[model samples]
Target chain A: MADTTWLTLAPAFLLGLTGLLVLYVDSIGRSTKGPIAVLSLLGSLAVAGVAIALPDALGLGPAGWSFVSFTLLGMFALALFVQPGSQNRRLIAGLSTAGAVGALGVAAAFLFTFDGEPVNPFGDALVVDGMSLLFAVIVASVTAMVTVASYNYIAEHSYQAEYYALVLLAGTGMTLMASANSLVTVFVALELASLPSYALVAFLKENKGSVEAGLKYFLVGALSSAVFAYGVSLVYGATGSLQLTAVQNAITGEFTGMLGMGVVMVVGGIAFKTASVPFHFWAPEAYEGAPAPISAFLSSASKAAGFVIAFRVFTEAFLQVSESAGEFLVLGADWVLVFQILAVVTMTLGNLAAVTQDKVKRMLAYSSVGHAGYVLMSLAALSGGGATATAKIEAGQFVLAGGMMHLFVYGFMNTGAFLFIALAEYWDVGRTFEDFTGLGRQAPVASVAMTVFMFSLAGLPPFGGFLSKYLLFGATVNSGFVWLAAVAIVNSAVSLYYYSKLVKALWFDERPDDKKPLEISSRPVGLYAAVIFAAVVTTAMYGVFGPVSDAAIEAAAALL
Target chain B: MAVDTSYYLILSAAVFCTGLFGILTRRNALLFLMSVELMLNAANINLVAFSQYYGNLTGQVFALFTMALAAAEVAVGIGIILVLYRNFEDVDVAEAATMRW
Candidate 1:
C-alpha cells in the first residue's frame, strides 16, 4: 500500500526531473533547441508508457490512467509538432508540455483510482478524488493545447526557455490546487500556479501592453491571495484545523460571525481566480495584452482550476453548515444565493461587455467571463438541494457533472478560438474585428475551423458546447432554480450576437483588392493540427456525452 | 494581564483592513506590494495566535508555510516591479494603464 502511494507521485516527480534536465541542458549551452526538444519529447513519451504499463503505480483507476496517458500523448504531440524548425521554441514547448503531462498523469491516476472516498495522502493534506482528476484532465489538456499553439505564436520571442518553464510550472501549481485537501495546501498551490502566470502574462516585456497587463494582474492576484490567506487564518481560528474534513467536523454545531466572514472572504478570493464580476476587472486587459496562447492558458486552464478548488472547498466544507445551526442558516443560504446572483451578473455583464468590444481577444475575454457565470450556475444548483438527503445528493451530483462536462467542452472550444487568433497574429492580422475581414476567402480551412469554434462557443447545436450547456441548465432546472437557467438562456442568446460577429467578419466582409491569399505561415503545421483537432473534438463530443457525463456523475458522487 | 486570542484576532483584523485600504488607495507599485505583504502578515499573526490557543501544531506549521510563500511572492513581485520601472520610467500603477477597455 505504501509503495502504491509513492508510485502515485511518480509522474509529478518525473515531470519535475524533466524540467530540471531541460534547465540543466540549457545552462550547459552545449545543446541547441532541437536536441532539448527531442529529449523532452522522449522523456514525456517514456512517462506515458510507464503510466500505461504500470497503471497501479499511481493506483489511479483505468479511466484515470487513460486520461493521464492521453494527456502525456497530447503533450508529446505538442512538443513534436510545435515550431518544426526552431530549436529554442520547440525546446521550451517540449519542456512545458512534459511538465503538464506529468502533472496530468498524477492527477488522473489518483482521481481514477480513488474509491469515491477521499484518499488522504501525506497526512491528509492532499486529496485524490473524482473532482480533482476531472480538473487534472481539463487543466493538463489546456496546457498541451496552449503549448502546441504557442509553437508558432512565440517563435519570434526571446527567452523561450523561461516562457515554457513558467507555463509548465504554473500548470503544476494548478494541478496541485485541484488536489489540495487543506486550506494551507490550497493557498500554497494557488500561489504556485499564479506567481508563474503573472510572469507569463508579461512575458513579452518589450511590448508595453504585455507589461502593463502583467503588473495589473500581479497586483490584483496578490491582493486576492492575501485576502484568501486571511480567510484561511480565520477558518483555522474558528476550527483549529486546516485539514478540510477536520474543519468541517469542527465547525459543525458551531456558529460564529468570524467563520461566516472567513467563508465569504474565501469565496471572494476564488471569484478573482474565476474572473467573475465584480472581481473580473483584470481579465479582459490581461487576456488582450498577453500573447494569444498564454491568454488561452489563463482563460481555460487557470479558470478551470479556480472552479475546481471552489467546488472542493465549498461543497466539502461549507455546504453542510446549513444543517448544523439555526443562526448560521442564513449564512449558508447567503453563500448559495451569492453564487446564484454571481451566475446571473457574471454571464450578463460578460456578454454585454463582449458585445461592445472591437478587439476579438477582448470580446473573447468577456465571453470567457460569461462562461464562468454559466459554470457557477452549476454550483448554485448544487446548493439548492431537494427535500430529502438522497434527493439533495442526486441533485448535487447532476449539477457537478453538468458543470464538469461544460468545462471539458469549454477547454476544447475556447482553446481552439484562441489558437485561431494566434494564427491571425502570425499572419500580421490585427486583433480587431475589421482585421478578420474576408478571412473565409483567404484561408478557407482556418475560417471553417474558426467558425466551428465560434459556433460551439456560442452554444450552437450539434457541438459539444451545446450539449454541455444543455446539461448545465437542465441540472439547474432540476434543482428548482428555473430562473437561473432562464437567465443562462438569455445570456446565451446575447452571446450569439458577438460570436456571430466574428463569423460575419470572416465570411461577409470583402477582401482587400491588394491582399494575397492567406498563406500558411512558417510554422503552420502545428497550429493547423491543433486547431483542426480541437474543432473535430468539439463536434465529435456530441456522441461521447453519455460516457463523459457518466464519468462526471461518478466523480461528483465521490465528492458528495 | 494575559493577552487573549480575541485580542490577537482583533489586531490582525485591524492590520488587514489597513493593508486593504492601502492597496485600494496607493498607486505606486512598490507601495502596493508592501500593502499586500502587510495583509499576508496579518494572516500569519492570526495563525500563530490560534495555534497557541488550540494547542495544536497545524496552525503554526501553516503559518510557517505562509511566511515562505509570502517571501516568494515578494521576490516575484519585486522583479515585476523592477521591470515596470525600467519600461515605464516610473513605478506608479496609474501610469501603467496601456490596455484599458
Candidate 2:
C-alpha cells in the first residue's frame, strides 16, 4: 500500500555491493570470507527493511517470517564460513550464495510491496515498475541458484572472488536492463550485462573449450552491440530523443526509413542476446564450453533480461509507431510482421537443431533457443501493433503477461536442468547422452528432479511448463494470431522429442561397459541443494499458477 | 560551412563496412578487435553528426557513452584474445576450431 519505490532497488544494490566487497576481500586475503558473510548478513536483512520501513508491515505475515528465517540463514552461514584453513572455499561460496539469495529475497519482497504504479525515480533513465521487479526476482533467483551450484562446481578453479563478483555484477546489470526506460540506458545496461558474461564464459582460462567459446561469444557479442549502438544512433537521428515515451511522442512517419531500419537493427541486436536463430551460433558453443552453472546463469537469467529489453523497447518506445503505420497492422506491414517471421523461424530452428545434438549441454542450448521463440511471440502478439482500440490493447497485454510468466517458469526449470548438468559435471559423469545412461539408478533423488525438469521443459501436463506455454499460446490465439499459435504448437510438439531424449537416457538406457561410475563423487551438497531448490519451485509453480498469472497480468498491464 | 550530416553518415557507413569486412576476412584476433572498434566509432560519428543536425546534446552525450562502451569491450576482447593465443599457440581465431562453428 506504501510507495516502496526505492525499496525496489534494494536487490541490485545488495548484489552489486556484495560483488565489490568480495573482490576487495579476495585482494586483501583469504580469511576475509567470514567477515564478508557476516557483513552481508546486514545487506540481506535489507529485504526485511521493507517490513521495518513500512507501517503495519509486520502484520503482512511473510515479512515477519522472512526476517526470522533470514536471521537463521545468516547464523547457518556463519557456522559454515568460519571453518578453518586459508582459501576457505566455503567462505567465498557462502558469501556469494548469501548475497545472491538476499537479492532474490528482496526482489520477492518488492513484488508484494510495489503499488503497481510506474515510478521514474531517475528521470527517464530508469523506471521501477511491477515488470522490472518481476524480472529482478527472476534474475536474482537464477543468480542465487547459480552461486549455490557453483559452490562445488568452482572449487577446483581459482579466482573464486572474481567469478562470484562477475556473476553478481552481471545480475545487477540484468536487473537494471529490465528497468531501463531509454535507449541509452538500455544499451549501457546491456553492455554491463554482456561484458561480464564474456568473462564468465571464459573463466576457465586454461580450458581450450572455455577460452575458444569465450572468444567466439565475445566476437559475436561485440559485433551485435556495435549493431545495437548504430541502431540507437539512427533512431536518435530520426527522433532526436532516446527516451521511450519521448520516442513514441515523436513518431510522425517522418524519417520512416531511419525509424524502420533502426527498429529492425535493434531487434537484431536483441536477437543476439536472446540467442535466437541467426545470432544463436554462439549459444550452443558457449553453453557447451563454459562451466555448467555459468551456462545456467546465461541461459536463464541473462536471456530473460534480453527479452525484457525487447519487450520494453517495442511496446513502450515504439508503441505509437504501430498505430501510426496506417491500414492493417501486419497485412503488408510493419516490423510487427518481421517479429511474426522471427517468432516462427527461431522456435522451429531451435527445436530442430536440438534434435541432432548428442551432448546434453548443447542440446539444452538449442532448446534454450526454442524457448526464446515462444517468448518472442508475446511481443509479436502485441495488441496487433497498430490497433487504437482498448480491447485489442488489453489482449496484447494478456499475451505479454503470458510470456513473462513463461520466463518466470523458465527461470526455474531451465536452470534446474542445467544445474543437473553441473551436478553431472561435478561428479565426472561423462558428457554425451550415452554417458547419462543409468544415472537414474545412481542418484535417484537428483535424477527425479531432472526428470521433472525435462518433462516440464517439454511442456508436459502437471508441470509448470505446460501451464505457462498454454497461457502463452492461448493468449496469442485469443489475440487473433491463430497462425502464429499453430506454428508454435507444432514447434512445441517437435520440442518434446528432444527434451525426452535425455529423460530416456536417464532412466531407460544402460551404462556402457567400463564407463566411469557416477558414484565416484558421492554427493555434491551444493549442487543437490541448488537443483532440488529449482525443482521444488518449478513443480510448485502449478499450485501457485493462479497468483503468478495474475501478477504477470498486472505487470504487463502496467507496461501497456 | 562545415561538412554536411549526410557526408558524415556516408563516411561512417564506409568505415563500418570496412570494419565488417576486416572482421570477416582477417582471422587474427587483434585484427578482429580492431574491426569491432571501427564499427563502434562509426556509431560514434553518427551520434555526433546527428547531435548537431538535431540541435540536441543527448546524441553528443550518447556518443561519449559509445566510446566508453567500445573501450570496455576492447578491454574484455583483448583479454579473451590473449587467452586464445595462449591455449592455441596462435592468435588465429580459426585455429581453435575443435568445435563445429
Candidate 3:
C-alpha cells in the first residue's frame, strides 16, 4: 500500500519538478534553451516509462497506462517537432509540453491503475477510480494536442517558456481536480488550474483583444470560484464534513433548505466553468480574443475538467441525496427538473446565437456552448425512475458513460477544428467566414482536414461525433427522457446549419481577385501534425466505438 | 446577546450581494477586481464562522487556502489590468469590448 501510494504520486511530482527545473534553467541566463528542451523531452519519456511500470496494486491498469503513454508520446513528438525560435522561446515551449505530458502521464497512471472500487487516499481527500481516470485521460489528451498546436501559433511571441509552463501547470491542476475527493481539494485544485489559464489567455501583452480576453475570463472565473467557495462553506455548515462520501451520507436524510441552497449555488458556480447559459456570456469573448491554441485548450481541456469534477461531485455525492429521499425531489425542487430545463435552454440559446455570428472563432465558441447542453442532458437522464436501486445504478452508468464518451470525442473534433483556425492564421487568413474562401483550392490537405472536423462536429455519420451523440440520445431515451432526447436531436440539427456554412465558405465562396493563394510562411510541422492526428483519430473512432463504449461502461460501472 | 452562526451567515450573504452588485455596476477594471475580492472575503467569513461553530479545523484550513487563492487571483488580475491599461490607455471595462457578437 505504501509503495503504491508513492508510485501514484510520482508522475505529478516529476512533472512539477520539470517545470521548476525549466524555470531555473531560464533564470540562470546561460545557453539554456537546448538543455531545457532536452531535459523536458527526457522527463516526459521517463514519466511514461514509470506509468507503464506501475504495479496493478497501484490501481493504474494496463488500459490506463496505454492512454497515459499515448498522450506523453504525443507531447514528446510535439517537443521534437516544435521549431526552435530565436533564443529561449523554443526551450520554454518544449518545457511546457514536457510538463503537461508528465502530469497527464501521472493522472492516467493513477486513474487506470485505480481499483474498480474507490480508494480514499490522503485520508479521503482524493479518490482514484475509473471516472476520474477517464476524464483525466481526456483532459491530458486535449492539453497535449493544444501544446503541440501552439508551437507554431505562439512561435513569434517572446515569452515562450512562460506560456508553455502555464499551460502545463493548468493541466496539472485539472488532473488534480479530477481526483480530488473533498471539497477543500476541489477548491484548491480548481484555482490551481484556473490561475495559469487566466495568464495564458492574455499572453500577448500588446494585443488589445488578448488583454481584454484575459480580464473578462479572470473576472468570471474569480466570481464563480468565490460563489463556489461560499457554497462549500454552506455545505460544510450543513453536513459538518468536506469529504464527498461523508457529505452524501450526511445529506441522505430530509434535506434542509440550507443544504438545498448550498447545492444550487455549487451547481451554479460549476455552470460558469462549463459555459452553460446564464453564465456563458464570457465564453464567446474569451474564445474569440485569445490565441487560437489557447482557445482550443480552454474550450476543450478546461471545459472537460469542469464537466468531470461536476460529474464526480454531482453523481457520487449529490445524486444519492435525491435518491434516498424516495422521490425525484430535493428541498422543494426537483433537481433533475432544473437540469432538464437548463439543458433545453442552454442548447437552444447557444445554437440560435451561433447562427448569427460571422466570425468563425466566435461561432465555434457558441457551438461549444451548445455541446455543453447536450452533455448536460446525460446528467439529467441520471434521474430516471427505476424499479430497483440496481436498475437505477445501471441506468446511471449508461448515462454517465454516454456523457464521458461524448466529451472524449469532443476533445479531438473541437481541438482539430481550432487547430485548423490556427493554420489559417499562420497562412495570414483572417478569422471570418470570408477569410476561408477558396481554402479548398489553396491548401487542399488542411481544407479537407477542416471539413472532416466540421462534419464530425455537425454530428454527421461515420465520424466520432455522430456515434457519441447517438449514444447520448440513446441513453436519454432508455432512461425515458424521450422529450429531452428530441430537444437534443433538434439542437443537433440546428447546429448543422452553421457548421455547413463554414464548409460552404471553404468550397463554394469565391476568392477575391487581389488576394493571392494563401501560403504557409514557415512550415509549421507540429501544427499540421497535431491537426492531422486529431482528424485521423476522429475519423477512425467510428471503427473503435464498440471497445470505447465498453471501456466507458466499465469505468462508469466502477463509479456505482 | 451574543452573535450566532445565523448572524454571520446573514452578514456574509449581505456582503456577497454587495460584491455582486459592485461587479455588475462597476466599469473600472480595478474596481471590478476589488469587487471580486470582496466576494471571496465574504466566503472566507462563512468558512471561519462555520469552523468556530463546528469545532473542526477543516473549515479554518479551507479558509487559509482560500486566502492564498485570493492572493494569487489578485496578483494575476492586477497583471492583466496593467496590460489592459497599456494597450487601451485606460482600464475602463467598457473599453475592453473589442470582440462582441
lDDT, candidates in the order shown: 0.80, 0.84, 0.79
Cα RMSD to the true fold for all candidates? 6.2, 6.7, 6.1
TM-score versus the correct structure, for each prediction: 0.88, 0.89, 0.88
lDDT for A84 (candidate 3):
24
| Model 1 per-residue lDDT tens digits across residues B7-99 | 998899899999989988989999999999999999999999989998999888988988898898888888888888889999999898777
Model 1 stretches with alpha carbons more than 4 Å out:
A31-89, A98-117, A253-255, A321-333, A511-523
Worst 10 residues of 3 chain A by lDDT: A77-86
Query: Whose lDDT is higher: candidate 2's or candidate 3's?
Result: 2
TM-score of chain B of each: 0.95, 0.95, 0.95
Give candidate 3 regions above 4 Å deviation. A9-11, A28-86, A99-115, A252-255, A321-333, A512-517, A520-522
Minimum summed lDDT over a 10-residue window in model 1 chain B is located at: B92-101
What DockQ would candidate 1 receive versus the native complex?
Answer: 0.77
* lDDT of each residue in B1-101, candidate 3, tens digit only: 38898899899999999999998899988888888888888888988888888788888898999999999899999999999999999999888778762
Q: List the residue pairs that clash in candidate 3.
A: A59-A113, A59-A114, A60-A112, A60-A113, A60-A114, A61-A112, A61-A113, A92-A161
- What DockQ does candidate 3 score? 0.77
* Per-residue lDDT of A407 in model 1: 90
lDDT of 1 at A86: 29
Q: Kindly indicate the candidate among 2 and 3 with the higher TM-score.
A: 2
Give the local distance difference test score of model 2. Answer: 0.84
